[model samples]
Target: MITIDLITGFLGSGKTTFLRKYVKYLLAQGENICILENDYGAVNVDMMLISDLLGDHCDMEMVSGGCDSDCHRRRFKSKLIEMGMIGYTHVLVEPSGVFDVDEFYDSLSEEPLNRWYKAGAHITIVDAGLRLPLSDTSRYVFASEAANAGVIVFSKTQLNNPEAPSNILKYLNESLASISCRRKLKASETVAKDWNDLTDEDFKRIESAGFKTYGFEKQQVMDEHKYESLYFMEKKFSLDQIKEKASAAINDPECGGIIRIKGFFKDAEKGWMEVNVTKDDFTVAPVENGQDIVIVIGEKLGKEKLAEIFGEPAEVHAD
Candidate 1:
């Protein structure tokens, strides 16, 4: 049976960044691994970020977003079953931020998959310097996702947020209480070191961080939740211009609770560059190649108003 290690976290929690590091570590251990990106977006920008990691020791696959919950899960299971036939010893799953955790276990516990794959590490990455007073929906998501995680790794501690480390813990426990989940994170089970400074020993611990079978209040999420992602293809804008417009949408109320804006476009001088922005940080980095598209993710998004902000999208894929 192949080991399927899951890396889960909330939106903009740096799951891709951490997964890149974890994949490299597995390859070093002589582990032939496959990365299954179960993303919830029209276009998976993350795939481009990790494309360079593809080679003999590792392979990559993705289940695209913009489908109903049941449809998405079926695709996820089908993809896993297909990948199971491959000769890899391990499969790393990076699901979308608002994924149904139950699907991860349910799919693996079924007939053919049960015989081919067993569960491995279940790690959840969190933003250390999180600004509090997150919407009730967002807080519920934060606790719900981390409820069964065997290890909780905090990101962006190196930036040194004043309220971090301690503040984050208090908020997490409170969020868990709201969800009525009995499980709570202990300090011993968490890794708070910088990603660059993370030693092999730290990764070894994460590798063996088997999941905890904990239960939480499972309510109908889609009926109440209003998360969305708006995509714009073939937009002509410089890096500076896009950043300015992205910041406006992220901060403005007309756009509705916008959480993250990310995508890629071509520039005159830089050729191809990626636009990755969250409420906390704004970063535009150069890439070798990219699609001329942008995606904006948030809850209860005002579609038409946003279209006016970033110009009309060639296509719109939303839930």
Candidate 2:
């Protein structure tokens, strides 16, 4: 059976960042790999990033829009069938932050899917920064993702002290205990690491241990909160300007409780920069890409205010 790894996390949790290096490692092993990019939004921004980073070495198929819809699930199943027929040794599934973790596993138990592919690892990335904010009822989607994950990994660890992950791990375990989950994950199954600092050995350790995952039943619950994505077309802004605007936008109540802000932009003075912002922290790093677009993900965002903050030619869409 082909390995089917579910890479899940809440908004701005670093799923794409982890996959960039993980896919490279899989390719080095000479394994045939295929990626099924499942995004909740109509736009495939993550797919753009994966393509820019991995290029032609990987096979990719995208299932865009809300996964809760029957149409989306059919598309997803078709993609899985296609991958199986192609005989890929491994498949990496990157589901949107708002995805239903149980529904993902349930899809596999159905006909045609179960015969071809066996469930592999179900890893969820956690943004240590937003650990507290995710507790709100509006953020139940995030909680569900955590409750079902086999190996919970932390992203943006550099922003915190060495003990932060351990501390957060304890907090997460306690949180999971509070909820009546269908499956239980051991402490050893949860890990914390900075994607930038990972070495080949680190990847190997994760893959070796993470592949053994616990399965859960689907709940079929839909997020009551709205998730919207705004695309900033113009990218020529100073690093300071971009940071300042992001800070202002996230803090403003009129902005409708912004949860995640990410995208590639060109700093007029400092070259290209990648901006990733969660409620806990904001990060701006220089990147090699010349593409100048920034995608912001959040709930009930103010279109006019976002357009003004992100600059002109902003296109807003449902995720």
Candidate 3:
């Protein structure tokens, strides 16, 4: 079975930016993945950007405008299945800015594609800079998509109003509570709320709510070793060397790029050490049993000539 993640957000809400980060994260974890882009208009900008960033490693599918409602979803599912048949281990869908999450979820929940694909996460991106209230339809649409999500990320914070994230979260919690009676809605709670607060009873409530919402299990700590985002470019080395270099890179003083890093690497011992930098700390995990892949997002560092920094490739394959 393939893990499918749906990325939803309003126009200019940083969906593409989030996707870029995510793709890098997956690549670093060495996951074989495909990206499906659904655009309301004629142009598929997200698809083209994904292709450019991931190159041959990503399979791109586009569902353009013109098809009837039913037909559009059918075509989308067909494209996903086709990508799955091609041996993609995971699929990521970036719906158009105008797409509604409830409709998309309902469509998938009732479909033939549901059997083959398990929804991993629904990530909705909101522009922090916009300073928009969730009451607006566009903002509501963004929140609705994330209402049942396993994870909700607010992107482009650098461009956002400082208080936007908190505002959005407040609205999201209330909305979620309104629709899901099982889970109690708490106000003024941040995403960094303690996991212990989510006791067994909370879990039961969440389960009963029909949406599985859980905090990331990893301990959230702020250490120099932690990173929010990191990026590596064209690093080639033996597996052992790749691991060593990654370890060293994570310890670098300049690791404050993002809370995570997503990039590609070639390793001699492991053939590849796709690195996942999670939680602003340099804790690394290999995805897909250590294959040659790119890292999309994890903990953070800026673009560096990884190939030159790391020495000697254990092997090379056509990309």
Candidate 4:
């Protein structure tokens, strides 16, 4: 059976960055792989970031969001069944930040997929400097995403305080306990090394790390009402102007917990550029191709104020 790995984490937790590195390592080992970007938005902006990785060794696919859970699950299984016919060494699934793990296992347990695919690593990326004092709903997402990880890796550690990792771990356990989950992770099950310094052995360890299962009180917080993604399209703002406006949104509590601002816009001078903003990182870079759109991801996002800030969004979608 071809191995299927789930690379999951909460919003702005660095799943895309880690997936890029892991995919590169897999390709270096001459493995044929496909990335299934299972996002919960109408647009899959993250997939555009990894377009350069597309080629013979690495194939990219996506399951577009903006549908009900049951419909999305059916589409997910259909995509898997279609991909199963293709000969891939491994399939890596990067789900939306607010996904339920049960969908993955439940889908794989069914006919055709069960025999064709074997569950592989359940890697969850944790931001080293994950801000404390997240809402209970956000806290539930944080803990549940990590509940069954084979290995939980911390990103951007070198940029954070030395105590950030341990502090975040403590918060994670607190979240688990609050949700009535008995699963508690240990230091050995996690790796906090900087991604730039990861060695071949480290990659091997991640690939070999197997997932575990434990029961937890499940919440129905994975719906779109819990997390809102506001989309702004065809806005002719330079990267600098966008950043300035985004900074305001981040600092404004009235914007309603805006955590991520990402997507592409055409710069008058530089052509198209990609922007990914979070509390920790504000990155803008040139890209060869992209659609003219910007998306803000968070909870209870104030649509009116966001429209005033980023220009009227094309639409608001939740997955």
Candidate 5:
């Protein structure tokens, strides 16, 4: 049977970063692995980054526009079956940040999926800095992720005070105790640690952690209009200029509530550059070679406003 590990987290919580580290370890072990990347946006900029990093180490498949919608759900299941047919020892599923774990579990219980694959581990990535915002506004989704996770990993630990993650973990333990299906950890085991700081020994525990079962089922309804994406192809713009415009667009009242902005772009000075933006941070670096594509994901986006800000994109649509 194939082991399918679900890596879930709320928006901008660093799911991709966690996956990158795990995949590197898996590759070193000579594991036959596959990655199923699900993105809420129509464009898969994360995939581009993943490909650039991983190269030919593993097979990759992407399900764009999320798996929540009925059409995409069916497509997602079909892809699983296809992966099974091709044969893989492990399948790493990186669901879109806005996704619900319940939906993932429900799909696995059905025909074909259950026959071919087994639940391996449930890992949820938490952003140490964004805990409060996540708890306040996205409690349902945030809590649901924690409730279903067997091992909870944290990101952005280096950016926060040393005492903050403990407080956040305490809050999560209290908030999720009643709903979480996985076994509870003692106070000693509840602190959140940085992904980079984790050693190989640490990962063995996470990957081999016992599978969990979730019974609590309060599903969070997705606000369809709340998330939208704009895609740009072959757009050549100065990185500084793009950042300036994106900052303005994200701050604009008409295009506020932006969650993530990332893509590969052609830099006038550099060869190819990749940009990743979250609520807390923005990063840009030169890549050897990559597609010139820009994908912006946010809520309440105004096309005209964005066009003016980012210099008229090739296409804009809902994700």
Candidate 6:
């Protein structure tokens, strides 16, 4: 039997970046890994990123049209069985940005795939800079995914504003409460907080907050609809240019209802900086060597509009 981990998140939520990092972690632990990338569009960006990281140490399978419909589901299950037959140890499945883990799990649990692989856990990558309240449908779904996950990891935490950490905790608690699973879910406070203490705080805060901790969570009041979502994906850009554009966009007087923005950029001096924006707050940090990919999730902003604001793309290749 192979352990299968589901990695899910909304569009431009750092899912590919998280997968790359996780692959490195698994490699460090000497784990044999296989990756399945569900590509909704013709371009499989996540698979490209993962391939660059895994090199030849891992196997990858692409399931097209898996974002919706059962065709990809059946193909995915068949591939998993094939991998199991070949003696693969662990499998990681990254669904499309628009797909929900609950739906995927429900679909998988009923299939022949259940015999070859068990859903080990779910890891959702959230853009901390989005600063989304637990009430938003996207955030609610993310939180629900976390509530059911054996281990929940909030990525891009370093790029979040000061208020992000607390808001995330609030959302986590609220999601857990709605699911009726556990009112409190432990989270690391200092990145060094003991796991036991973290769990204790999860319950205490939920009880005091006057909210349910776990069960099926409801969607919150979302000011912007899915079509109105702010989304931007750029291959490469000058770090300074990205910062200036982001600052201007977030501070624009006409920018109403804009919520989340995230992506990566490169500075001549700083190498790579991952950008995350929530509400009016934004953060940019210099990362070591990383790919030159950036995505911005915002409300009411379209790709063409964002491209215009960010200027013409640069031709620099990501090392």
Predicted model with the maximum TM-score? 4
Better candidate by TM-score, 4 or 5:
4
Q: How many pairs of residues in model 1 come into backbone collision? A: 0
Candidate 4 has which clashing residue pairs, if any?
none
How many clashes in candidate 3? 49
lDDT, candidate 3, 70-176, per-residue tens: 55667666676566567777778888665645545665665566777777766656544443343333333444555556545555454445666676666666655
Mark the regions of model 4 whose C-alpha exceeds 4 Å error after superposition. Answer: 268-271
Backbone clash count, each prediction separately: 0, 0, 49, 0, 0, 21
lDDT of 5 by residue, 54-169 (tens): 44558899877644577677778878888899878889999876676766777888998899888988888888877364433356567677776777777788889987777777
Model 4: per-residue lDDT, tens digit, 1-319?
Answer: 8899999888988898899999999999889999999987888888888899999889988997645888889999999999999999899999998898999999999999999999999999999988788988899899988998999999989989888898888888888888898988888899998999998899999999989998799988855478888888877777778889899888888898887888888878888788888876898888877988888999889888877888888888764
lDDT score for candidate 3 against the true structure: 0.50
Judged by whole-model lDDT over C-alpha atoms, candidate 5 comes out at 0.73
4 against 6, candidate with superior lDDT: 4
Number of backbone clashes in candidate 4: 0
* Pick by lDDT: 4 or 5, better one: 4
Question: How displaced is residue 85 in candidate 1, in Å?
Answer: 1.0
lDDT of candidate 1 over 1-319, digit per residue (tens): 8999999998888898999999999999999999999976767888888898999999999997634778888899999989999888999999888777888999999989999999999999998977777888788888888988989999988986645876787789889988888887788878887899998899999999999987888755543556777888777777777888898888889889888888887878668888788888987788766898888888888788898888876655543
Candidate 1: lDDT of 118?
Answer: 94
Q: After superposition, how far is residue 282 of candidate 5 from its true place, in Å?
A: 1.7
Which pairs clash inside model 5?
Answer: none
Error of 2 at 136 (Å): 2.1
Give per-model TM-scores.
0.95, 0.84, 0.54, 0.96, 0.86, 0.63
List the lowest-lDDT window of 10 residues for candidate 3: 216-225
Please tell me which predicted candidate would have the highest lDDT against the true structure: 4
